[model samples]
Target: MVMKVLFAGTPEVALPSLELLAGDREHFEVVSVLTRPDAPSGRGRRLMPSPVKEAALRLGLPVLESDPSDPSFPDVVKATGARYAAVVAYGRILRQPVLDALEGGWYNLHFSLLPQWRGAAPVQRSIWSGDTVTGATVFRLTKGMDEGPILSQSTVEIGPDENAGQLLDRLAQDGSRLLAASLEAVGEGRARLVPQSPGAYEVARKITGEDAHIRFDVPAFAADRQIRACTPEPGAWCLLHAEGGRDDTGLVLHVLRARPLPADDRAAPRDLPAGRLARTKRQVWVGTKSNPLELLEVKPAGKKAMKAADWARGARLADDAWCG
Candidate 1:
């Protein structure tokens, strides 16, 4: 018999899994979908529905909007009589009543391995912490955050300079397929549960405005890592000396792309000051505590993104102008 599936999710990260399940109408019936309530967004502050709601509407499926703690949530979910529920980036934790309704119980699609980066912001935290690897986890939900027992797991390599946004996009695509496979395994009663290893785990704290500030005095490689971790959300930037001598104010610029200096890149200064700009015909390099970052693209405040070298041409960045 086809399984009745209830999907709870919000945001683009959840769309792929929803789409995958929705597409398999013969094997899986998406009885209901739960998404966050419409909220104001963009410069105009227009109300916008969550991505999952948008997709559910496209498929002509039932959609509900409410917080997880709402009194009506369990009744609404129980109305569907779904055997299983798939939760991905739902933005709210599941309470016990909703958990007990599903015969097959609820499963989550988390971006990192279980017991690691369990809370929100896993991808961002992994990149910021300089981890060389991260992956996706499928687990049965319990009450203890992401501490659930895993049904399946897959490993993904962290690219050299990938930020949270880029990594999320990649994982979404991978998770689209992985989640479907996992659910299929569980349905066939062939899935195996694995216990996570102890002590290598870390939590991804939510990103804040303070985390976006670029500290030029830090090592170039470390600074680059920060840029990669926060990009496209809270962009990584620093204060530089602008023309007309405005007392060296903060010049926020979004880092679009960056590359690390090679071990033999002897041209950089040993004690190069933070926020100092170096340029060549092809690229613009910025000084950190050690080495330099070759900035391929940047977006200065109130301007479109441009090549760092192009920005350097109009703005003369003095070598002595270091970040204070």
Candidate 2:
């Protein structure tokens, strides 16, 4: 029998799994999708539907909305007549009443491996920690934040310089396939949730704007990790300080791409003074406590994102100008 399933999620990343399961109608029936409602967006502040809602409409599936903690939410879940639920970045915690409404169980597709990075910002945290490997996990939904029984998992290698956004994009795709397989296995009576061992695991706390500030006073490698973790989200930003330029207190310099230069063993000290900006014809490098970091792409204040060299050429960077 095709499993009647309730799909719940809110963001663009959720679309892949929803589409995957929707296409496999013979095995899983997506009775309805539960997602956060539209929110005001853009300069006009017009209400815009979530990516999941947009995809659900385009796929001709029923859509539902509710706060999970609402007392009457159980009735809403029961109304769908769904035995199972699948969630991907649903953006809200599931209340126990909602979990009790499903017979097969609620399965969550998380970006990080189980017992590690178990929280809202797993993908971002894993990259920041210099983890060589990270993956996705499909686990049974429980009250604890991402503390659930493991159903299925798949591993992925983190590229040497891959930023959080780029890595998360790949994980979302890999995770969609893993989620589908886990649900299918359950339908085949092979669902076995390995109970997670009770222990202290790394918690992936949310990445905030304050956390995105890059500190060149630190080792180049450490600063590199901080910049990469914030890329394409809060974004690695700095205040520009130039001798000839106007007071740059309000000038924001966005560093889109950068890498730490390998320390030279022959040199007495790896690199020069920290925070100083230096440039060549084709590249811009920022000094750190150890080896300097190469700034690849940057968006200077009131400028479009471009190669770091291009920004340097236009700005005619002051000799003592530093990034803070």
lDDT of 1 by residue, 39-122 (tens): 899999999998889999999889988667877777777888788888899988788887886779898999986788988889
TM-score of 2: 0.95
Best by lDDT: 2
The estimated TM-scores of all candidates read: 0.92, 0.95
- Against the true structure, candidate 1 has what lDDT? 0.80
Off by more than 4 A, model 2: 244-250, 265-270
lDDT of 2 by residue, 1-324 (tens): 699999999998888899999999889999999999899998999999999999999999999988778899999999999999999999998888889999888999999998899998898899889999999999999999888899989999999899999998899899999999999999899888898878999899999988887899998888888888898888989877855344657368999999888766332233457888887778788889888888899988777899988888878678877888
Task: Tell me how far the alpha carbon of residue 156 in candidate 2 is from the true structure, in angstroms, after superposition.
Answer: 0.9
> Model 2: C-alpha RMSD to truth?
2.2
lDDT of each: 0.80, 0.88
Backbone N/Cα/C clashes per model: 0, 0
Candidate 1 lowest-lDDT run of ten: 315-324
Give the Cα-based TM-score of candidate 1 against the true structure.
0.92
Clashing pairs in 2: none
